[model samples]
Target: MGREDFERMARAGFIERNGTVVGDYDPRLLELLRAMDLAADLPELWDLFDLMKAVPLLVVRGEHSRLFSRETVATMKARHAAMEAVEVGGQGHAPFLETAGLPEKILEFAQRFASSVRAEAPSS
Candidate 1:
């Protein structure tokens, strides 16, 4: 996003400023002028999602995330059966995991998966 775009989004309360996010963001399409600062190259990964369908998936989604839309979440669930998805209210992409009860829920999910995995026997 250019300076003008960031300024516009900030003015509209879409982007965060000073560590505070305004709730209830309506997803809007924006022109991609260039690659993200943190990303080197953006590769298509829908096939990867199909390839990993057998693996368990726990999706934490922001209700208003434009990048990861609700349709995407639904598509992921349709592609995978052993999937658990949690949507955070009034948040955008990569919602703050420190939000109420999120940390505990993540820990619980980890423990559940950890106990379910069987350890391989050592071949001494």
Candidate 2:
């Protein structure tokens, strides 16, 4: 959403009252925006998955995200047969990790992967 829309939402109590909306331009944020703008033209590196074939991959996408589409997730799964994917419901663009149970999911995934690794490790 744009700044104006975000401000309107904040005024209407849609966003948290404690949160600060950038009512004025911040110079530091401008630098961040400039960097993001420059990074936008970078080429997609989906093929980099080839190097991560041995790594445990977990792909979490917002259910309504335009950036990470279902097709992309499907292709990721097809390319990395072991990749696990999950979509957080009722979120757009990016999921709110604090409210989306993402931390718990990540912990579960890490624990499961760690267990598998331990099981496969040779006993000294």
Q: What stretches of model 2 exceed 4 Å from their correct place?
A: 1-41
Candidate 1 lDDT over 4-58, as tens digits, reads 6456556655546588776445444223433355456678788988988766678
Overall lDDT per candidate, in order of appearance: 0.74, 0.78
Give every collision pair in model 2: none
Give per-candidate clash totals. 0, 0
How many angstroms is residue 76 displaced in model 2 relative to the true structure, after the best TM-score fit?
0.4
Question: Following a full C-alpha superposition, what root-mean-square deviation does model 1 have from the true structure?
Answer: 9.9
Per-model TM values vs. the true structure: 0.60, 0.65
- Stretches of model 1 off by over 4 angstroms after superposition: 1-44, 119-124
Q: Worst 10-residue stretch by lDDT in candidate 2?
A: 8-17
Question: Using alpha carbons, what is the TM-score of model 1?
Answer: 0.60
